[model samples]
Target: MTATSISPKSSPDRLSLSELEAYIRTIDTSEYTKTRNYIGGSTQLSEYISRGMISLPRIRELVLEKNSFSASFKFLNELAWREYWQLTWTAIGDDIFDYIRPIKDTVRPAMPEAVINAHTGIVALDAGIRQLQTTGFIDNHMRMWLAGLVCQVAKCDWKVGAAWMHSYLIDGDYASNHLSWQWVAGSYTGKPYLPQQDNINTYTESLQKDTYLDQGYGEIASMEIPEILLETVDVLPAHEATLPEDTVTLDGLNELKNADTILLYSPWTLDPLWRKQDKAIRVLLIDPDVFSNGRFSQQVIDSIVWFAGQVADLKIICEPVKNLEVLTAAIIRKSYPGITTWPGIVDEPEMLFPEVPVAFYPSFSSYWKQIKKYSMTDQQSLF
Candidate 1:
């Protein structure tokens, strides 16, 4: 998305420490349940949640305050999907970057040029790409459709398309971003997700027709890529997703050398109030080596810095985790291209199911059923 489109509804909203709690109080899940599947429907809060400005526990608490578990299940189910992906990442380790399941029907294996240019002839897909590039935001349904178009319809490799989309998303969490694309590409599920023409028009209201997408659900598996969509840019794996070198001038971190404890935060773990009571030095460790797995736009970088700023007395540094270890006995950070690995702490990143079983979850519904037994996680009691 572009600078002009960076609104709260589209991109992640920055809230000062005081404004955020108030923001949480006003969240309503009613409309999310009613129309979240539409292209314009549930854009309200995923970006915020994705960036860790808000937590699912807090959201679930708010939803439960007004409705029962069953009444709020749909919205909570959506939240669970995010947790499911993260848990899958934890369970599978670096496997999320690889195709979990392979398909025999893919005709092409690179990202389309039209998606990068935002000129796909399909009205809904083109608009979504524009919104993603311009606003760092697009609804989830659109994301799935775009992924389906690239991987299923256009026959591009999901790895290529996923890396391409991850670069532009403001809410670019690797587990969520890559895994969701895997889901659409039939690599992470039993069948590839192909959107029918009516499905696109019904939710997107584009009402356009006579393209390759204008087919019944049953015929979509064999549909040819449209001529306009046939032109594509070769991705590194999808084509080549270049991870930028970790090169930000580090804020002075030498000053904190004598501190008793270090509460390290990678981009994956930035929150203002985390461990606030623990007397420790908070450092926003910008380990390019770890976070360099996907390409990000300036807007994504800006959102991250904005989020990091919310933490009080946070030290910003640009270095590999190993370098920091040499700087002091301070904790080290080491992340590879797409997988985030922090050697300093054994603590897991936030997830509804923080510990994933060693076995792979064949589907989210199964993961949800097993985790739901205790993952409902009555977060209000913690208050």
Candidate 2:
């Protein structure tokens, strides 16, 4: 995909905190159905972050409105998931990827037709998938619904569904998408939550009543919509890569004016237009699908072709799973001599930190605050 044509200005409108609050204010207070649907179901704030209009702190504040104990916890928990992925990367270094592959292999030997065609016969899930495909937002409840289908019904791996969902959703976070799918698949911390047909029917009216008539759902009758439980844990900041010993200084970049370097990205944060600043290089190495490419390779192919011109050096690096070594191997095989993957701080600087599971980290918030503070000043390092 050529970076020249994919202008951020041309993309869809992203919802802001004020807009979200205003939207909430307009809803009928007595209509609990719409309240749950709109507040719990919405994913538009992620779209704002994807569009670069809001910061993560802003997102955290807007989402963590403690209207009740549960609402506050759930909103913050989602943000913690994002933090956890970053922390996991820092703690395990490249080994985080090992945790990802087996899960992928177990669930997805082949991409399932029921998922691809939206024919799981579960209407809420089908509508969720269709909505995700079309509008790029699915309710929190529907995410579980669709993910459950991918695991239990479609018999596809959670990674496959997670990968595809990451590509399509504007605000898809690596930790939440992958881990939540695992949670549904009975691989994450808790028991596998397979929503029964009656539970689906109660929350969603779009499904045909007789579709799951024979499928057993006795436990689903007692099932409740799950919410997040929050806890505080220490965390390293996201994208905390090490500054290379021989890294070019700001003065050095201005002085050289002649280094012929190709741009490569170690994607930490999700940005739609990641390769725009590299006026010097025609070739860019990136995960064409933005998150990972297990499920929708064709869409990523089209997106890459649409944004980056012809792909010269294709390297596959799915975080918490694939590493720079694997990606470097691919780049070398492609004969792209100068292409390099961005090394994480865990690999480069060599620090010891906690192996804490996902949690809200208010205590360690200021410790690594300056990591990306100099991003604008040191923009030339990656390219």
By lDDT, the best candidate is 1
Candidate-wise lDDT, in order: 0.68, 0.42
lDDT of candidate 2 over 136-234, digit per residue (tens) = 567767788777765654455565666667656644545456667766766554355565666666666544575542257553323332211011112
Number of residue pairs clashing in candidate 2, backbone atoms closer than 3 angstroms, sequence gap of 3 or more or interchain: 16
lDDT of 1 by residue, 9-124 (tens): 22245566456656655546676677888877874576566666667676676657766566566777787787777677767778889888777774476778887887777888
Q: Which stretches of candidate 2 lie over 4 Å from their true place?
A: 1-12, 15-40, 50-53, 61-73, 93-108, 213-383
| Residue 22 accuracy (lDDT) in model 1 | 64
Candidate 1 deviant stretches above 4 angstroms: 1-13, 235-253, 290-294, 329-340, 348-359, 372-383
RMSD of each: 5.7, 13.7
Query: How does candidate 1 score on lDDT?
Result: 0.68
Give candidate 1's error at residue 72 in angstroms: 0.8
Residue range with the least summed lDDT across 10 consecutive positions in model 2: 330-339
